[model samples]
Target: MRALRYYEEQGLLASARSGSGQRLYADTAVNRVRLIQQLYGAGLSSKTIAELLPCVDAKVSTPESRERLLVERDRINAQIAELILARDRLNDIIDATSKPNPTCDYV
Candidate 1:
């Protein structure tokens, strides 16, 4: 709930107020929140997400927005590649240690 209000304050989301002044959200709000969460997970800042939201809402992309999206995608790809290498290295270490060695004391 706090996150919803924060998102709203950041201009990343919208809500309607009831007569009693409670915030109300449309059904589409669910999908919007999910997309916002995904973008944040992808390491996008709130400012960038705010900029991207209009493009998303309109289903149209300007050249700048397209470039920004591509840049973020490339960054995530590079991070993924680095993580895979680290995981493979850990696996190699585990494989070597798991083999029985006569000189090793630990079970």
Candidate 2:
């Protein structure tokens, strides 16, 4: 709920209020929130998400936005590569630690 409210405060989400002052979200809001989450997960800041949401809402992308998308994709790819390297190193350590030593009394 805090995230939803934060998104709203950041101009990334919208909601209507009921008579009792409860927030009402349209069905489309679900998809919007998911997109926002995906963008954030992909390493986009709230300001960047705000800038991109207009194009998303219009279902169109300008050349600048397309360029931005490419740049962000490249950044995500770099992060993924780093994560894979880290995971492989961790797996190697785990493999080394998990092997049984026949001469060890503790085994």
Candidate 2 residue-wise lDDT, 29-95, digit = tens: 9999999999999989999999989998999999999899889999999999999999999999889
lDDT of each: 0.97, 0.94
* Candidate with the greatest lDDT versus the true structure: 1
lDDT over C-alpha atoms for residue 75 of model 2: 97
Global local distance difference test of model 1: 0.97
Q: Could you tell me which residue pairs clash in candidate 2?
A: none
Q: lDDT at 49 for candidate 2?
A: 96
